[model samples]
Target chain A: MKPDSPFLDLETAPRVAVSIDGAPLELPEGANLAAALLAAGVTVFRHTPVSGAPRGPFCMMGACFDCLVDIDGFTRQACMIEVSQGLRIIRPRDLGADDVDA
Target chain B: MSTHDLIVIGAGPAGMATASKAADLGLTVAVLDEQPRAGGQVYRDVDRVAALRGDILGADYTQGATLTAGLHHQAIEHVPGATVWAIEDGFRVSYTRAGRGAQIAADRILLATGALERPMPLPGWTLPGVMTAGAGQILLKQSGVLAKSAALVGCGPLLYLIAAQMVRAGTPPVAMIETQTRSDLIEAARHVGGALRGWPYMLKGLKMLAEITRAKVPRYPGATEIRIEGTDTAEAVSFVHRGRAHRIACRTVFLHHGVVPNTQAARSLGVSHRWHAGQSCFAPRLDVWGQSDVTGVFIAGDGAGIGGAKAAELAGRLAALKVAEESGRLSTDERDRQAAPLRSAHARELAARPFLDRAYPPFAGALAPEDATVICRCEEVTAGDIRGHARLGCLGPNQAKAFSRAGMGPCQGRYCGLTVTSLLAAANGTSHDETGYYRIRPPLKPVTLGELATLEHSAPDTAE
Candidate 1:
């Protein structure tokens, strides 16, 4: 992570190991997944299927779907997820990330 | 199915207060919310955040702890981390938790779904580095994450509060690009008398501005032609201020132009909605008691209209009292006596809204952006496309949505519904009311098929 990234790490909680886009990183436990990713210098959360454009956590609430990511093969809002051990997150794209959903 | 005397759809100030108030009135209450805690967005994760960084979030946010404390009432079931997806006739509620679905029944339903930031669609707003100011507040509250030196753009008191919050966190914003102009000020002055009745709120805003001033953050008022400029990500914010064009180099940009009622859950209920021209959005047509056209269904808080947090709490109390009386738990006279003070307090809390509405109306072009600006983030539909659909004989937002798939994303038009309505309104030369919003359907949140399969279907509640 950049020492002076635009986000400050105010979390003093113990860190846990989580994989992002297949890379391992230590993030504060129980932190919001989206905020943790951003603080860890992972801004681009997913690529839009329509235009293939990079998108991040815009609303940080569930209203904006820009923070969608694949956690254990299910597309979910990173902002809605809490950081935990062994959360495998990947930014799925192109073929429509949520096609598996009803 | 779990049954209740009343089911509250959100755990915001309104929902939380309603649950406790109704429980006090001897009505069994259930408060379901998507957050992990009781403090909706305004006070999300209030207990822990209060201990971790209460000083950074300020007293206004930490005060939510008191509201959350009431969730512990035995008569009130605080079902946190549950996203409500369906509200059927006869008070049948459907929701998802941990990718599993469940159904519950209630005699009464109160939607306190609250507000969402109005989408500030401009060139390159879809870039990875741009976010709403509300998102910044959420990060700080939920996870103690603070944006560092980001430019706070657009308008409203929220921008000031966020700038102040960041200042206190020791990572003051790089600048504030305000969109309110002289005309907005003149328009706001007409309502200043009533706004002064809300002096405490106005004072809070002033203090926030003072904090920003103390931090020496650069302020650009009356900014026009605002745009986020970059290729892969937001690199800088460019705008015209005082007739001189300037570009500020910044890696991140936080945008705001006030908030609108998050009407998705309300609209899904098929309730009547009216266009609010001042706020430039649609609000559910609700009675003074916060009851919607659908009998026994109520909407309080920002979901009914954008009346901030305190007003929502009052609305919740008033609505709960009405429900309690109608349920035969309280006498009509007693209900009125209980609601009288709440009604007055609600009025006082909302006194400044008209001024705030005019002073920081949805920024021009937000409703009708340039042809290239993407209005629908999910479908990547642009304003020009919606207008093109209008030219292609699309009559309203629904038709435009059907023609261009503008509101088909997982968000279900939460972000772009108003913009599509406005673009079509202008294109068809009709009133915004005529150019209605998308017809929001069931499963308000994206529910997987496997999740829906978990729902144990039950007949709608027959108890009136």
Candidate 2:
């Protein structure tokens, strides 16, 4: 399925490649990470540790931290971060299983 | 810690205005914001949005360009991407920027943190495709993205505004389900005379409604019993309109009722707030000069109350003028002279608030969702669980939080505070204020222990 993106064609804008949970993706440089992820059909950002219910980005702004993810080794708000090249993003569950040294 | 003359939190309309006005008056000002840009929420990404997609955003957005330009004065220091963790007595602020911890003390502090969309907890709101209307607008503003099709639900001028903007962007929703009833119109009619004093706002709202109608978008007014249904994500919205049940097939559902002041920073600083009856939310109490009960602390803009961007700008200027007078930079007569026009402008800007408040007060029923609806997204606590706790004599939000872990999550009650307060009040048969809000403590936003360990203590006199 093609991702839903309303962004007008900005051909000159640079594109960057990144990996989300080991799945390779390409997004416009400087785009909000959460928006890019959503446009790539990645809906479920994480599941709650307690109830294990699925949740995704509710407030694209930083007020709701539903878009928490593991960027590199640190957990961060995906809505607040900008897309960058070669970024290794992992879901919360995957981050939990990986060694701290990863 | 380093000391400065003034420190402003948030870079939205209120904060940028305060910093610019104070700096222009010869007071050194520093602005700290979590976003990389200075244009707060309403005007988020104004520079880039204006440059890239100016027409689709309309004139209201372009107005932000002037404010963002004003932030460039030499006397105003802008510290973007700084997350303030705590505000101590003596106007001391500790924050983390780029993973480094630092502290700054100010002779005076101004908090203009702005507003958040009022929580509209409904059945199936926890589903994946259910999101706030404000969040959808932000996505369009920041990234030029829109869902293939969605249903817009809720009441307020913002709902109409976003729908009209979407129509202009050529991605109008499949339908708009507005919750305001006929009685709301009658109540608003009582305030029309007062609202007419702010003629521009009334006209702007009319224009938006006209545009939405002209676009031929299906609208369901007097909507109730609204529920979004889907197996794993929102697939459709079912609601009752004009005594008939209607279901619209759509993948996305956007919800909004209105906005409330973001009082976490003020509440954490021991600042006092009173329940604002007109807006149906708690706001920090302030004096004529915007000074709170705490000495050297002032709050202006929507964070103090839900004044729009224009009023926020004027309020910020007025507060800066008061700061100047207090600091002996301007005599009382000069200060009054400087403030005379701004006070009038501020009054003009606020004249339409009473009408809007009455016309689209949040649907009381929407505050308390169904038994199975999730109240806290982070902890997955349901409204049923909270009501049960309230039955067990949970008196207030803090006690309720202890029982259900509703407010004890990363977002820290930003999304669920208002809803939880309403649920407790209803269970106890009391007013919202009587139940009180969550007792917010610092670090305000999450900061890692590793970040705190990297603090570089500054000399006693310098400002960092």
Candidate 3:
């Protein structure tokens, strides 16, 4: 039996407004901050010094800290950290070697 | 701690065989597992198979089932649903049972933790109706529930096995889409030729495929664009083959990119590993004896590599022989002689692997899902975000995480890390393993913040 899709039919995914590194962005309600950031055009969530590389969520789960970002000065996994209205995220400095322009 | 001669960490064929052999040698042995019943994943109790009588579980697993029952009679302590978290010095095992934590130690540790089905993500992959081929089997095994109408996607022996299982369950699938190319099958045939030494087992796989065809399930070869659609939950999937679009309407979709090694425990022990390109997963490097770089810890079965049950059982027996020899229980010559049969069986079993690998190469397009496609369902990151970060010349997965927060989700990169790594590796012109997804440290699953807070209250602080 074919059942209606909750995502398509009811759009059950909640909506949340998020700000990445002080930049305001609206995202799906209940979306994790990293996901909300990706949806809101905030791709470069943080920077790494060792190789000046772009990093994002690797293990969607907390086992991999690859998706850590600054949410109000606290380091957290974007996957694990749920997004909420008016959530303020801070982007760290020295994110990448290429970030000289930023 | 009650001392045992052997502590087998699973009750599948590998663990059972290891415990049985060690017991036969008159060594005290105990087998620990997390399943209510033994047989592990392969022999998971499929309700469909159970209804058809036990033999439907497949003879290989049925034998394992029998062996496990026999092991119980030998008085091996079988711990089910015990989440083993650590293996300390002197083979001390720390595990959590129910709501409390406990520890045990053994003379030798045999890790046959087995394998998990590799996750292959696509758009709408996180939807409710989509599930792994293994998960589908589990539902059938435990609940006797069928998908009513389902679509089976992906390739290799599991594809055929699942098809035959679905048929036997009285819920014939609507279609089966194979990603294997025709050339792959020809190559696989050559590989299968060498494995014909184990021809009886090979024929069983063939029989399953034949049954699927007779069931009138349309088979699509070299199928790409496999997708589950419907929006919130999956309703149907459409794929293109030979420049034609074929859509199947089904409530459930079962996908298998093949098996991946269960390396969390091994990695935690600091055992070095290399990413297997052909298998597209990470596996520990074990010598012929399944000994990791660590002196005493041995790994066997699918945890070493995916070679099916026969190969795994033989590997387990061989691993035990090596341990016996190392512990000075067996002479060198005697060990070699005792292991010869298993080694020969291993050679035969592995003969078909190259062909299987060729027949079941991961769909490159599928591997690198579209930028908008959801890579991390828990965090909802996309391939585009990963690629956009890669464009900034981020060299590795760690840096990618800094730039896009891709791997930092609730699932902790379990689902998306590999996918994102491949995408970033390609865009930055690096090897996938070089970018290495994430080094998994244990307590692999999430422990509630409250639970972790209480650990300090109970355990004596041994840090000093």
DockQ, every prediction: 0.81, 0.51, 0.04
> Which ten contiguous residues of candidate 2 chain B have the minimum total lDDT?
B455-464
Please provide, for model 1 over B343-419, each residue's C-alpha lDDT reduced to its tens digit, 9 standing for 90 to 100.
Answer: 89999999988999998887785756999999999999998888788888999878777788889989888889888
True contacts kept of each: 0.90, 0.51, 0.04
**Whose DockQ is higher: candidate 1's or candidate 3's?**
1
Task: Output the better candidate (1/2) by DockQ.
Answer: 1
Over 4 Å off, model 3 = A1-102, B46-56, B73-75, B187-192, B402-410, B448-464
Q: What ranking of all candidate models by DockQ puts the best one first?
A: 1, 2, 3
Docking class of 3: incorrect
Where's the lowest-lDDT run of ten residues in candidate 2 chain A? A4-13
- Candidate 1 reaches a DockQ of 0.81
For residue B225, give model 3's deviation from the true position in Å: 1.9
**Candidate order, lDDT descending:** 1, 2, 3
Best by TM-score: 1
Interface RMSD values, listed in order for every candidate:
0.9, 2.9, 11.7
Residue range B292-335, candidate 2, lDDT tens digits: 99888999899989989999999999999989888888899999
- Which residues of candidate 2, in runs, are more than 4 Å off? A1-12, A94-102, B459-464
Q: Which lDDT values do the candidates have, in the order given? A: 0.88, 0.86, 0.68
Tens digit of lDDT per residue, candidate 3, span A1-102? Answer: 112311111113566666765666666664445434433434344544433333444333234354567776556666555557887876655435345755
Q: Write the per-residue lDDT of candidate 3 for residues B66-129, one digit (tens) a residue.
A: 5566576464777775656667767877665554566677767889978776767776665545
